[model samples]
Target chain A: MASHFDVAAYALGTLDARGTEAFEGHLASCANCQVELFELQELPGLLDTVAETWPDAPVRGAVIYGLPTKRRRFQHLGAATAAAVLVFLSGAVTAIGFLGWDGADPPAASEPPTALTRLDPVAEEPGGVRGSLESSTSHAWVETTPEGSRIALDLGGITGSTPCSAVVVSRAGETTEIALFDPPKKGERVVVSGTTPYPVAQIDRVEVRRVSSGKIITTLKAPEK
Target chain B: MTERAEWTESRQSAMLPRVGRHTRAVRPVAVVPDDPKDEWVRQLYRQFANQLSAHVLGLTKYDRQWTEDVVQETFIRAWKHADKLDQRPEMLRGWLFVVARRIVIDTHRGRQVRPIEIRGTDIAEDRVGVSDKADSTVDAIVVHDALRRISADQREAIIETYLKGHTVDEAAVLLGIPPGTVKSRTYHAMRALRRALRARG
Candidate 1:
């Protein structure tokens, strides 16, 4: 039989599982072992009662399983690597996001208030007056005037081997053929600027086409004012 | 071997008598108060939950909600296995430590297999509330006073190492001392604090 201290240690969980089981077997008939186990178990309760001020904050799932499932067996390695990458990426993204346009410092609050006018051309172009004929892979600008409006199409970002063209139509059935640039590249802007022969309020639609494949990628329209 | 097996069967049958005419005529066994058992379970809960929570929080970088969940699960498991808990209150503490450790391992493993959403905002608020409540507790104030009554070096070591959660090396560096010295001082300070708190009680 082991000494009282050994049994106590086993009961306390300081011993490995085999040692604990052996000790427990001995403890079944030994009154001394039972007494010691009782004593050691109280230590946790005392510490908890004293440390009552800290509320339990449960760990979140994202923090636990951020790594891919395949690497779970090597959790130590996986967690360490994932944590390092997450921390690095978070810091980098935060730093970049904070550096607003023209290198302005980020706002004091962590989250910035939503911008009122989100008129960045790349974002608004897809839902612009032009429908599917609008170039998905291109940048566009729409400038409205009291009399008419002009749109500059830049289809540099589109991926295709074919060439494209554009056609503009007014609400009054007046049609105009705006020549499309072939395979638009960076630094090339297709300007379709002209006074609408119809009144500004009557002009309705604009369309861009892929001439080689005969596909309409962009379309724009003016809602009845 | 057959005799041993028959003995085991008979023991089981004796412990669990048949529920029939003869059993109904026999008196039930006496019910005894298990004060030690109840106290031991209570003590285990009291001793381990907060420290486990603190350790988990520190390990996980103050993930407030996860710490709470782990603590809650640890205690619930302890309660469920109350029969297995040691009778000595001191041993109960260590038993709970082991349980808490297992709970942590299980939690970590489960997290690997599942998707977890971290609610950053609520955790921050919960931590603030916990700290505020701890500060308001009378025992905390008493402990703080006892801590102040100790030697300045001992008090400083305790404050920086345990209360402030600084690593021994970090506290040593801050105090311009060696890590070993810092550790020894903190240990002695803890002993002193324990004595003081016990005396007050």
Candidate 2:
């Protein structure tokens, strides 16, 4: 019992003979060490199998040993590294672009849209309301800008890359095709926007539907005036 | 032991058998470098090359070309970070494993995003999906990721005692520290690993 810190050492089976003897003497009466030892019992086995979880464990007798030491290998490797870096950069850029879209920033690539929140006071009209069709989730808001009414939509749970259109319908049964875009991959947020000449007061609903089938995927309603 | 002697010993031990099998494929030319950084990187590479290759080969579905690329990339990164990296053998191994593992993961994700026809038409249907198929696979990634989250010393401790299967006294010699220090580092590393696994889950 000179050292009670041999719990991990003993569990790891790394304790020297004398140290093991002392720890076992202490362990006979030590309930705390017993519990600690039991908890760690699985650790070594798990560690041994950690490398086995990958795709080709035991390697299948592949002759893939040693680093590529040739000068020619390094040449192509240089090109591969550049391409890999480009792919990584593009992925990062796409992520950042999506984050920007999630904000009030519009999705147009040519000219940046004026910030919707900074636009002239959103006319005292119907406020935004949440709506969904089936399992899909969607939200839409109409902001009155000097140019026209800007509708922002956040649609999620869309499956596949379907070409879709956002149509704004007024209470008077008139419809305006405001935006056309592809829905994002499944389980990802799709933030999009479209501008309409109609004001916020006149618009009654916004529906996102497949461009080909014209079937509604989701709709966001404007609160009644 | 001198770094050069250690490098030679480690390299020969790991490369001897493989070299005999594939004599033409590998030249096994040992280059003695003048620069300290080059020497350090060579040492790290020699010591951990086999371990990284095996782990990364498994990761890349034993794609020899891809495994070599990842291993190369990992060492390049280690070379770039050599100034900041702890020169200890165990710490270097941990750093290499984490970096190499991430390269494998990133390459997989990149391929998934834009399927590259590297392995011909039959792209191994199962690998095309998410990396979370099996609980053990997820655990492997989680554990490797957690290795980087802990301090270098603690990471080295776990590598010595658990991963490398070294006894406490043996680990002490390899780490150039006392046995008590090794014990404490292993204990702390275990706790940090537990917390990291929980956080990841």
Pick by TM-score: which candidate is best?
2
What does the interface RMSD come to for each candidate?
A: 24.4, 18.4
Q: Where is model 2 more than 4 Å wrong at Cα?
A: A1-4, A51-225, B1-135
Across residues A76-185, which tens digit of lDDT does each residue of candidate 2 receive?
Answer: 54666544533432321111111122222233353221221122332132221111111113334344445556555545555557698878888687898877777776
List residue ranges in candidate 1 displaced over 4 A: A1-225, B1-136
Local accuracy of candidate 1 as per-residue lDDT tens digits, A1-225: 334445423422333444444444455345655554444333222322233322210111111221123124224556655555344323211111111111111222422212211212222221122111122223223333333443333333333457665566776788765454554355433333233344333445656667866666655543222
**Index of the highest-lDDT prediction:** 2
lDDT (C-alpha) at residue A49 in model 2: 34
lDDT of 1 by residue, B1-201 (tens): 453343233332233335676653343334423334335535655666567777667534577887776666555545445565555656555555454544454455456542243233222222222222221122332344445556889767655654454555577789999755665565455555555444431
Q: What DockQ do you compute for every candidate structure?
A: 0.02, 0.06
B1-201: candidate 2 lDDT, tens digit per residue: 364344444443333334454552333445543446666777777788899999788778788998987887676666556666665665666556655654665466466653343221122242422132222322333455456557999878777776666778889999899998988887777666555444431
lDDT of each: 0.42, 0.52
